[model samples]
Target chain A: MFEKYFVFSPYFWLVLFFFIPLAIIFKISISVSEWGMPPYQDIFLFDNGFKINTTFENYVYIFSDYYYIGSFVNSLILALISTFFCLLIGFPLAFYIATSNIRLRNILLVLVVIPFWSSFLLRVYAWKIILQNNGILNVILLNLGITSEPLQLLYNQYAVIMGIVYTYLPLMILPLYGYLNKFDLNLIEASKDLGLNRFKTFFKVILPLSVPGIVAGSLLVFIPVVGEFIIPEMLGGSDRLYYGKILWEEFFVNRNWPGASALAFSGIIILVLPIVIFQILYSRWSQKNEI
Target chain B: MKSSLIKSTVIFLGLFFLYFPILVLIFYSFNENKRVMVWKGFSLRWYNELFNNEQIIEAFIISIKIAALSATFATILGVMIGYSLVRIRKIPFKSFYIFLSSTPLVLPELILGLSMLLFFISLNNVIGFPSSRGQLTIFISHVTFCIAFVAIIIQARLTDFNKNIEEAAMDLGYNYTKVLYKITLPIILPSIIAGWLLAFTISLDDLVVASFTTGPGANTLPIVVFSKVRLGLSPEVNALSAILMFALIIIGLFYFYFNKKFKH
Candidate 1:
């Protein structure tokens, strides 16, 4: 009886709060937009006669607009470049940490990920101070005579990418370390003994084995970075707009409820839904392998 | 010897990249200069200002209250979900259960915030409840996202340990509730604490979701901090970041200690 209660209570809460909210997004996404207090007409209405009204105008509106489409493309490019840099930097660190003596490995791994514990907004804010015109980096440059004056550093897309990589680096490293830690160091020795050069040995052995880690880390960084708003808003200039910024603008800046809902729903459909299905299938496969 | 030298250099560089900004933030928090960029003799001017700033203090209080409450609630429900997933096999719509519990981990915060906001509006319209969005809405939102985090940690811990302990307790004639309360939960208590810490930090750190669901008087610390720093950096915020980052990093170390997952 108690066990059943344990399951049912949480089950009910998730369905009501989590599942229903997602359904509501889908519902409002399909609703008609109008000029009003709520800015979207109700789907269910009964006045002189019972009636149900909905429209796909929001979806069409977003698809047709170059501004919305372009912002999403920009986010994708940003995510791609950031994920690449994260992998470039993170892979080596994760590899070295995973290869360390077990005791040292544990300590190093903790050090790598502990920064994630700090506030995300503060981590990004820290970059703002560092990238300031007369900030430490510029001060060092001036002292070293690298540049005659401070370069504009803070409010640009490059700064956005730098902040993303700096913050999301740990996310990439942790998962890669998880998979890398499981492999035996002897594999490298075995590949070398087979007369393969270091490059060939790595490509033939270590790289193949760590594909799952690479994929996991890439998805972990890529998916969130695509939707990330804070980094771009805090660190970026108006030179570029991202999906997250556009979505925020639609809702809070412009107060377009249905349009915002549509954008969010489309994001789920385009970016999230397929991943959810893929993850479900992947878990099942992993479970079968475990069994 | 050469390869080892390369490895050490890579590790040191990576750590420097990771820690450089944090050290800068901490260093500047004590700078006496009113201009945040300029370094002067170290003074505690900003720390004094941070404590006296009523906006930040009130926001900090609200954030702590929300994070603690939501973390506790999320842990309870999350422990249940984790337990159900690992031990109980007869869950109806098990796939749906997995989907609901895990999707929040990956879903963008912006999308999640919008969905929750729309749901609350829809609820208020049809049911005439939650007439205003404030702490209650934010708390619910936090718990909803946080459950997945706690659940994942608990699930990992439960899966790693032997189930024979529970079986032995049952053989000794303890009821299901008694075994869970006395045996299973005790063994997983560290993980539960770890999960709660993770959830607490996540709730306290949230800005996007809270911004969407927040109403008058519900300004969380992150929201308040973001508004202050979004336009430009503030010295008061620098002081707050140093203090908060230190506190949070300590909690993280405690989490690693309790979970013991950091060990080889």
Candidate 2:
């Protein structure tokens, strides 16, 4: 009897709050736009003989516009580049930390994730301060004689990427460390004893084993970076646009609710839905194996 | 010796990259200059201004209120979901249940915010409840996303512990509910607190979802801080960053303490 209460209470809350909201986005996406209070015509009409009012024009408009498509592609490219850099920097750190003495390993792991505990927006803002023309970075560069004049480091794609890789690096590192920590050091020795050099051993033994960590960390960084709003807003320039900004502008600036809904719904379908389905299928497969 | 040198360098550079911006923020929070980038001399002027500022204080209070309330609610519901997923076998449409709970973990905040704002508007249109968005709306949305975080934490904790204790309690004289209240809840209490802290921080730190759901007089700390620093930097904000970072890091350490305490 109490079991039903446990199952049903949360189940009801999720359906009401979580699931319905998503369904609402889809509904609004399919509805026709209008210049009105709500900004979109109701999908169901009762005034005239029972009629359903819906249009796919919003989806068509979004896909047809280079402005929207270009920004999305820009975001994807940004996510890819950031994920690559994160992996580049994060892999070695996770590997070394995993290989450290047990006490040192715990300390390093905590140290790695500490910066992440700080406010994300503040952390991004920290980059803004650093990338300022007279910022510490410029001061160092000039004093070191790397450049005579201070470089314009703030408000560009590179600055955006830098902020992202900084903020999201911890996400990548934690997962990579989780997988790498489980790895056997003996495997590396075995490969070495078999006459495999460093590169060969990394590719043959280490890299293959750490694939799950790579995938998890990459996805963790990549997906959020695609939809990231603040880092770009604070650090980015007009040189590039991203999906998050476009979606924000579509609703708030253009006052195009349907357009924004369509964009968001498209994001859900293209980016989120496939991964969720795969996760569901994968978990089921694993559970079956366990049984 | 050579490989160890290489390892130390890699770790040093990696940590430096992670911490450089943070150190810069803290270092500049003490600058006496009105212009944030200019370092005239070290002083505590901005911290003084930050405390005196009403907007920041009010927003901070509102943020704490929402975070605490939402974290509490999310923890309760999350415990239920986590318990259900682990212990219950008769869940109807288990896949759909899992989908509802887990999707928020991966869903981008922008999309989630949009869907929620739209949902509130539609609900008001049909039901005439939540006539306007404000703290209530923000609280609801925070709780929704936060549930997944708390659930994941609780689920892991529940899974790791031995189930034999609960069985033993039941096999003795204790009833099902008695066994849960006595044995299971006590075992996972540390995780429960850890999950609450995680939820609290996530809610407090949120910007996008709060931005979407917030209304007049409901500006969160992030909203206030973002508004201050959007076009340009503010020294008062610099001071706020210093304090907020310290407080949040403490919360994070506490979370780690509670989370790891019962693991062994």
- Highest lDDT, which number? 2
Cα lDDT for residue A91, model 1? 96
* lDDT score, candidate 1, position B88: 89
Tens digit per residue, CA lDDT, model 2, A158-265: 999999999999999999999999999999999999999999999999999999999999999999999999989999999999999999999999999999999999
lDDT of each: 0.93, 0.94
Model 2: what is its DockQ? 0.84
Give candidate 1 regions above 4 Å deviation: A289-291, B261-264
Query: Looking at model 1 chain A, which ten-residue stretch has the lowest summed lDDT?
Result: A33-42
Assess chain B of each prediction and give its TM-score: 0.98, 0.99
lDDT per residue as tens, model 1, A107-170: 9988999999998999999999999998888989999999999989989999999999999999
